[model samples]
Target: MFDRLFFVLGETFTALRRNLGLAFAATGTVAASLYLLGGLFLAYSGISRYADGLSGRFEMRVFLKDGITVPQIKWTAEKIRSFEGVRQVNWIPRDKAWEKYSKENPEIARGLENPFPDSFKVILSDLKKGDEVSERIAKLPATDPDGGVQYLRDEQNLIAQAKDALKVLGGMVGGLLATIAAVLIFNAIRLTVLSRRIEIRIMKLVGASYATVYTPFLLEGAIQGALGGLVAAGLLALTHRTIGEALKSFSALSQLPSLPYNDLTLALSGAGAFYGVVCSAAALYRLQLRYR
Candidate 1:
């Protein structure tokens, strides 16, 4: 079995050398497909991380009605902290608000009366549940005697919905791209097999087992796929580096997480090798059916 495997490997290599153009074409196609996929994955990862970071800073300010004492404030804080998904309840005093506002807007600080209200800054574990937190906060016993606790960012729902929609759309687009690439790959492999029918038939007539004849084609596809993945990985790395250089001054993009060199290399290399192997196997299987 070991000798047979070596023989098949040598045959596959020879075939690849003989049909170098076709092999290169297959590799190029696979590389392009994998590159697009890797880019999408990279973008998704960055966006996901960004969203998570933003969610961590998500907080709802609950203002107290007039005449509320420290006891009432403590009660309200305890209730909020006990609620589901409530990570932490920070009580921002009017003084701290004034200080922060003054520091942020020093010009307006001069004549501005302490318009800051005593507010309970409630932080939630899940940003998606912001609306739930706001609703629960408003119903707090001492939230507001006359009026309710007003949400500063009432548009959070709209933003969350938008992000969810974009995620679904991205998934759909990725699936479509993958399907198209697979069909193209399958057809390309079939054509390659058809062109080699005479040689394959001769081998079978000379008593070569189906497995023996099958190995070389499978190996060829595997090789092409691997080469393609490698090319795509290189291209993606270069593209990212160039973009990083250009956007080095942009603080936001600079802070975004990117794939480390080792991870990217390994993933792309494995993907390429796997694609080559699978494409070769599939093509060989289909071609063998016709001969049998």
Candidate 2:
């Protein structure tokens, strides 16, 4: 049994070497694809924590009209924050709003005067009392003195926007890259099957079982996939250590924790291995029909 395993492994290596160019090509594709996917996964994991925090932190937004006094806004915020279930209140001055807007839309911000209004973000201990809290805020004389108080109807929109942004980016570019990688792997296996038709036919004639005939090829694919995944994982680790650290310094991004190294590596490696096995089995099945 040991000898057969060794023989199969040796043959797998031999096959890889024989098709060294295609093997390397497929490996590179797999590495790039897996790296992109793994990076997305880790990024989403980190961002989800931030998302949860943001969701918890911004249950309500109270927008003040233009020309509202800073003192008045602060007083109003304090009054609302003192209401039942209210935990925290933050004042967003027009300048701060302008700064945030410029950061988000630099092109559109050019030469534009700060027309943004003052606002307050309210976080509550019990979100179910949001309506009651809003009504209490409206009664405060310091809030929206010139007009009726404008309350944000849905605070969940911010979290929803954050989630949608990530999805849009992933679906467009990531989907394309993954498709390219899959096609590259599929072609590599197809080429291998074509190259080994005579050897496979000989084995079949010699009464080799299906597993005996195809096991080496299957393992070859798996080995390549695993190697590619490992390479991607290494790059991911480097990125997290360097660039990810820098991103954490920003106040908005500071909430995201660093990616867990070992878990991400294992996940990527497993995904890569599964990708290889499925593609190899498909290729082999096609060849088997042809040869039979």
For residues 1-292, what per-residue lDDT tens digits would candidate 1 score against the true structure? 8898888888778777767776776677677767777776776666556656655455666888766788989998999898887788888888899999999999989887898668887776666777777788888777874545554354556556656765675577655654554555555566656766777778878888877777777677777777777788888888788777778788666444565767787788687777667655665566555446
TM-scores for all candidates: the values are 0.78, 0.66
Tens digits of per-residue lDDT for model 2, 62-98: 7776677867787787788779977888887879899
**What TM-score does prediction 1 earn?**
0.78
| Predicted model with the maximum lDDT | 2
By TM-score, the best candidate is 1
Q: Model 1 clash tally? A: 6
Cα deviation at 291, candidate 1, in Å, is: 7.6
Query: What local lDDT score does residue 102 receive in model 1, on the 0 to 100 scale?
Result: 96
The residue-level lDDT of candidate 2 at 161 comes to 60
For each of the candidates, give the backbone clash count: 6, 0
